[model samples]
Target: MVSKAVVSTISLILVVGVALAVVAFVHHKNGTKSAGENLSPSMKAMIDICGMTDHQEICQKSLSPVAEKGSMDPKEFIKAAIQSTINELSKSMNFTDNLVKNVSSSARLIKMGLDDCKELLQFAVEDLQSSFSMVDDNDLRNMNDTEKDADLKNWLSAVISFQENCRDEFQDAPEYQSLMTKNLQDASLHTDNALAIVCNLGDILKYFGLEFNIKPSGGRRLLSEDGYPSWLSASDIKVLALQDNGRIRPNVVVAKDGSGQFKSIAAALATYPKNHRGRYVIYVKAGIYDEYIIVQRDQKHVFIYGDGARKTIVTGNKNYRNHKTQESASFSVLGNRFMAKSMGFRNTAGPEGHQAVALRVQSDRAIFYNCRMDGYQDTLYVQAYRQFFRNCVISGTVDFIFGDSATVIQNSLIIVRKPMDGQFNTVTAQGRARKNETRGLVIHNCRIVPEQELSPLRFKIQTYLGRPWKEYARTVIMETTLGDFINPAGYHVWNETSFALETCSYLEYANRGPGANTNRRVRWKGVRVINRREALKYTANYFIHAYYWLKGTGVPYLPTFR
Candidate 1:
């Protein structure tokens, strides 16, 4: 017979094992409950805000510290997004700098590409900081303030563009390109998340059950009853009222002959006043200036005009064969609030000399009135920021009018020149890489026609309105007259592999001409034929928020569709 001691021992062991199992189960259940309960209000708010973005995990992780500090304001979240982008970009820039240091001197292109990346990263950081400042300064709770919102979006979009441009510099170096892609991925993602939050800010606010006031559209006016911008100062009105250049007193004068104070435009630019409050005018006499002119970044509120577009010219021939596209421009404007009138900028690098830029504008709130940009390829590079071209003429062959700026060419003429044999023509190649970017090319009430040389060969040499230079390229040809030379397909794909047909935005509204028929246009998913209501969104008043700054420039602009 079994002993009673053995039976008692076995029973005790079974009881102990069951008791331990029960305790472990209770602990796990309580731990899960504790985790749920421990989620702070700030953490929950961060989750809610980040959930609206495409990259939720990245967004949440990047913004965790910001959330932990505990204010649930949507603006704070937006600020955190921008801050995160800035931080990542700084790190990426350092990484690029290290790569530059390690690169072999024999690899010139690679070194140049990395150097360009470093510069671009710096620009991206500046742009993100600008966005951050805007968010921090303004009470974005009033979602109806379109001007502030547009400016914020523009800066963030430019950050993305700068990052993409950095990567694009390494197109020929796949290995380097891959390295850049990996290095910039986090920075790009953070910028994208920031832009997404800004784009869907209204929805995010609504999600928070926050109440805000909307500004009435009817209260805003583009111009006063007396036919002038209501916001123009007395001094500005006086300057605009002067019809004759001789009568208007200029701060400086430039002349090829020794009659003026400065013999060259560059000399006149050197006289820019330090922190002057008002417009500083520079007038140039009728002469051809064979110089590469750059209005430096610090030169703001500069009003430079010439005798006439045909008489006074700034010409150069720096093509891609010798210099970088950014450095090949005959004229580059980097200042804000810059205005150029009755001037001509041309790149004499003929069609054979590819990727030559005539006028590269990186200025914000810039105006070009009655000016001309003449080149063969990559003519007018609207590099960044907001630009307005009124009553101007732009002539080129390939991707002539291109860049990542919020630009409007109104009452201007687009001349399409014949390209080399086997080469085609594309008027615009807008470099908007992200959908949330507010940058685009808007051709309003302009004329697009072929030059006399290209007229006969129009049928043989195909021409497209635009091509997707970047993935989210956007161009709107509305209220413009298209010449017969424009291809029936309307637009062209960048290449076989770069067919951004689904992501790019190409729109034509109320366009009239033989080439304006949408019936035969390419059936791209992103091409659209919209009504007036939709077209209004692309107007000067809405697209670039022109009314806010254009009023000061005194350039006549159609705020809305006629």
Candidate 2:
């Protein structure tokens, strides 16, 4: 009864409905895309940005909502990456906090570890905020700065270190360790992704039509002919001049004999000026003061000196027997731009008191010139930031000179002390945990010798240049003299697993000594005998970007190899 046109229309409608149903079935079957379907522009862009990271899936997932906004700005991508890290870190911190709250007081070690994890997570958040601030403040679309890039990477690297250190506190609690690891996995992955993006920031900027200028090693010198950093302030120059002429005036003095304004170093530090500018000088007279000293975080631009390294001593005996390693420091400096000269920091806990720290330096751009750090184990904790040790003496037995800071020890003496019997010695344990971290120990033009007690026992007790302390541990020994006491193998593995051997970076360049021979060195993938060009990369100028801050301290350093 119906017309032919009506019948044709029904047929067309049915065919169209079938095609739509098939497309819907295919889309549901393949979560990403249907067969022969092209990806959305924003999704493609997200893949491209996250392709540089180790965790592409996490990166893409974290950035999916941001990508939906359809903005391709690299800065936006970086900001999102940092935000994702902050989110994950916050979650982990909450998880740790709950664990700490629920932990029983009877489980002292576990409780202590949880408390440490909570504190470390707080630090991680602070570091992430710092990184985010840098990205948020700068308009990367038009800026061609490298220092900012380096600073961002450094902060992110510290975040990773803090997370790892939190996990390390649980070495005695395996169940807690596994739980913490699971909790921190996403945070760690997010951090790694953020760091990778920062490491490749220049390339990313270039892709977005901006050139990130990374100055070459051969660029203009940072120092002027007057042997000062070009960026040194006029007031800093006057202070250094006065120091050189032996007419320097100190803001405060500490004398054990009650001759100065303060009788003790701790008392002197208590009077630090709030929101002060320029250098706050403290002179400690020649005497031994048995007290723990901490230069608190707000005390900036502090310069403390003593009569001489041997004459003035700050001594303590706290060790692993009773206190946490972090709390066992004779002197801990948390202030930025701190400088110490001609002073000795000691932990007289003896070898029996393992993991006693002589000096713990967390100050940024800190300088130790002609100072001595003495202890049996874990002597100098170069905990963080850029530190310079020039003409200094550091003595220890096991993992003595260990930390995660970007450190350079030039024209110094590294003494290997006799350890407790059945225990060997390791001079340095650079704790660089991630590949993108700008942290390492660069021993340049130094002498590594055995202490008076260890000299004879050197034959029986083995000593190594260093060992891999973390997955990406990095240490460079260049133009240094190593004693015959050092093991010919040059380095040691962290464990039988040797997991770090394939990831760490150990380089020896132009080192001359009986133990410096690379012929008998461990055949690790990361160990290398570098050439001159490679050696230049580890020098003061390039390694820590010392030009920006070192010269300002008035500490004599080799900007390049002599």
Candidate 3:
């Protein structure tokens, strides 16, 4: 027979254990950890790994079965996680597709949103498959393997983004919410956990005595002290006749004082060769030449650099409020392989004036370095083909930087000024209409800050990173510093019924500062944190295809990026 004191003590211990269980249950229900640390090594490993992700508990739970199989190899463990991610993504595709079909709403908006979810889910599946395939490389020490690893990480990130996007699209559609809520959330949670492990690829590789870095090649540095690329040759560096500067003569010079080759920029452009084989460099001297300029399609290989970005100003006021954006640009470019440096293009439209494009670039392989574009809306239109913007200062009110071009805006300052009353400021509105379209927007190593005059309560003002102007819109913001002026939600919807929120691809990688904290970001799959590999793909060297021609221009740009 046990003593009465021992029996009481045993009963008390049981009561404590049951109370702890209830606490754990409540914590788990609230989507957080229970307050305890004692766990098995495998469980701890799961926790440790999942801790790096946004969804730790779910990640650990979903990956628990594979972990129990007892493989400690970090590589094997991660492979299993990725495989799990792939499986979930595939199911998610089917789930979203079936959900779309089952919805009873005949509203076009609901249909459009659901259709967007299916399209993005399909992309997620494809990307996840590619990511899984990439994980089977033979050696981790080789550059090929490193590149493959990078590609895998990018695809995985994309998978997570698409999944989140699918769910966010239905947030406003309460009628279809029940169908998408659980499955989409589960799919996103799985990928978020997978990406948490993938984010540590460098450290994980280090654990296996390996590393991943870009192969270094010997080359002249193209990046200037001002963060711009100096592509000018010795001849392009020279001054015009009667400028009194000791610099050499430019190919064609435009001077308001009539001291150079031509008095007006238009006159000089009119006389330009129609079929030039080599670069035709035109130098514009210091002046605010209020005329609207156009470099036609025949003016290929054109290089236009001005005296200074501020000193040489091109100003106009044509806006959609008055005229069409197609005809209202301060400067229009359609020639391929065109370059511009140290110039200012301005559309002097106020916040109320809409669709005023300062610079419209339709040129393929166009490069703008150390340029200033000032306007209210549609300040810089990256219209078509591929383009690069380096060391530029662009300021506007709404959709200031936009269009369908595959563009890389790097090492630039994008300023958002005070908008018209009751209007929100949107930085980018990418128009990638088709899934197969190669056009996208990559804003890398740039500073997105509010104008100083608009900053007393800047955080109170609504500023979004971007919005999807088209269904297949894609944009990546990498290694950038965003000011506190940015909205916590990061991006906005084009409209309550627009399906763009589902079909768009938006991501941020390695960003910093107060605005970069994603805790308050909208729970949309379109926005995510990407790996180094994905971020590298959008650089000026790689994203804009600058390697081929950038070198030829004597620009010391990274020979491997874009």
Candidate 4:
């Protein structure tokens, strides 16, 4: 028989284990409850600050960076957090008296730990605002791919930790009833407001995709050190005389004043803000501007109307034979509300194996009307998003009209100036990278003509309409007049016996002229010859958002194919 003392001791150990199990079970049950069901001390505190629980989701997203991601900077994230906390705390003026009733001595210790996080919250907000100010537009534009990726990754990690901390206040601390509850609820509301700003910033980024890093060939450079607007300014043009017949001439030799003249047109353009609204006009006299031009983002609602397309020309002679394709471009535009009419843009780099360009328009709301663009290979680079060309004439040889943009060309004359080697003709190189970029070129009512001297049979001398620049190279020819010199096989391969055409989107719709016969047109396996209706879907209204742009601008005469 066991001793009575030994048996009693064994029974006591079992009872202690059972008691511990019961306590653990109760803790787990309370932890799993919803925000409304089993409110933690921190949660209650947050509710007290916010004054209500209605905007819980907003708070959650705002605090998401601080609460979930950790060390993240989002727009309004810090602002929302502080404001929400203040709002919630003000809801109960009697919160201080009730605090004693809810929290025990142990709960007060837990609440103190949360108090430590207050500094972190303040730091996060200050850091975000400071970061925003610190990152100049130029710095942001110049940031390399690696630098951008690393910065974004670091920000995301900080946000994750911050969010996780928030969850701890709501779930782990059940003791300090009033204080903990108030902290949690207030933090949540602040996070929500912050998140609203973050989401808006995200939307803007999605559309612009962070303005591309400045490349040697992409950005504008100054030719003259004299402090003058590289291009004509609105103020300079105001003194000029505009004849009733549309001819314009500068009254006096306009001198650059110290007000805002920059080293280069590109430099001037770079300083433009994103959301600013106003009118800007750059009027040029009948003189050749030998320097490269860059129209920047803040130069919105801008009109660069020249005296004559051929006379008031912006000309450069950089060629691929001497310079790289990107370096050869004569003019570049990166403004939102941009327009260029009756201007001659020429890259006289000749077809001596040079990739010279006449014009490159890389803006959201860009329009080029009655303009002449002349170059050889890789000319007229449509380098970015949402560009349009109306009644413009482009002349080039191989892979000329190429780029990564959602572009539309209507009622334009496309001239193919063949090279001496009798190599390629009419290269409409489309650079559609993503599937979301379904917006491609829609050539409507345009005339496709080869060099006047070239015979119809000369088109067979190794000519192609476009080649695969990306997996989804979307280019279309719709209701255009194709000359007899166009190749019977409307499209040609980027390389012989290649698989590039399988994924590229080459479409033609109801194109007329001697070369439009179906039997003779190149029958690529995946090319799409869409109908008039399908082509119109990519036309003025849909692609340009014409109605929206003109709604309040008071600009009559919207562009149409008809």
- The CA lDDT of each predicted structure is 0.85, 0.85, 0.72, 0.55
Q: lDDT per residue, candidate 2, 131-185, as tens digits?
A: 9899889877433444566677778887887888788777667899999999999
Residue 502 Cα positional deviation in candidate 3, in Å, after optimal superposition: 1.4
Model with the higher lDDT, candidate 2 or 3 = 2
Candidate 3, position 333, lDDT: 90
Candidate 3 steric clashes: 10
- Using lDDT as the yardstick, the better of models 3 and 4 is 3
RMSD of each: 9.9, 9.0, 15.5, 20.7
Model 1 over residues 1-562: C-alpha lDDT tens digits? 3765885676566446434433443435445522344556676677767767887767876677767788777777888888989888998999998999999999877887788788778877887888888888877776455667777888888888788888888776799999999999989989999999888887777766775576566766657775566766666666766733346788999999989999999999988977765677899999999999999877877888999999899999998886778778999998887899999999999999999999999888889999999999999999888999999999999999999999999999999998988899999999998877888999999999999999989899999999999888999999999988889989988965656888999998999999888898888888988889989999998888887877645577899986
How many angstroms is residue 249 displaced in model 3 relative to the true structure, after the best TM-score fit? 3.5
Quality of model 3 by C-alpha lDDT: 0.72
Candidate 3 per-residue lDDT over residues 292-358, each given as its tens digit = 8988867887878898999998888887654545567899997777888889999987777787889
The 10 consecutive residues of candidate 3 with the worst lDDT sum are 235-244
How well does model 2 score by local distance difference test? 0.85
lDDT of 1 at 302: 82
lDDT by residue (142-213, candidate 4, tens digit) is 433333322332222223223323233333345444454454454444434433333233332323345445
What's the lDDT for residue 297 in model 1? Answer: 73
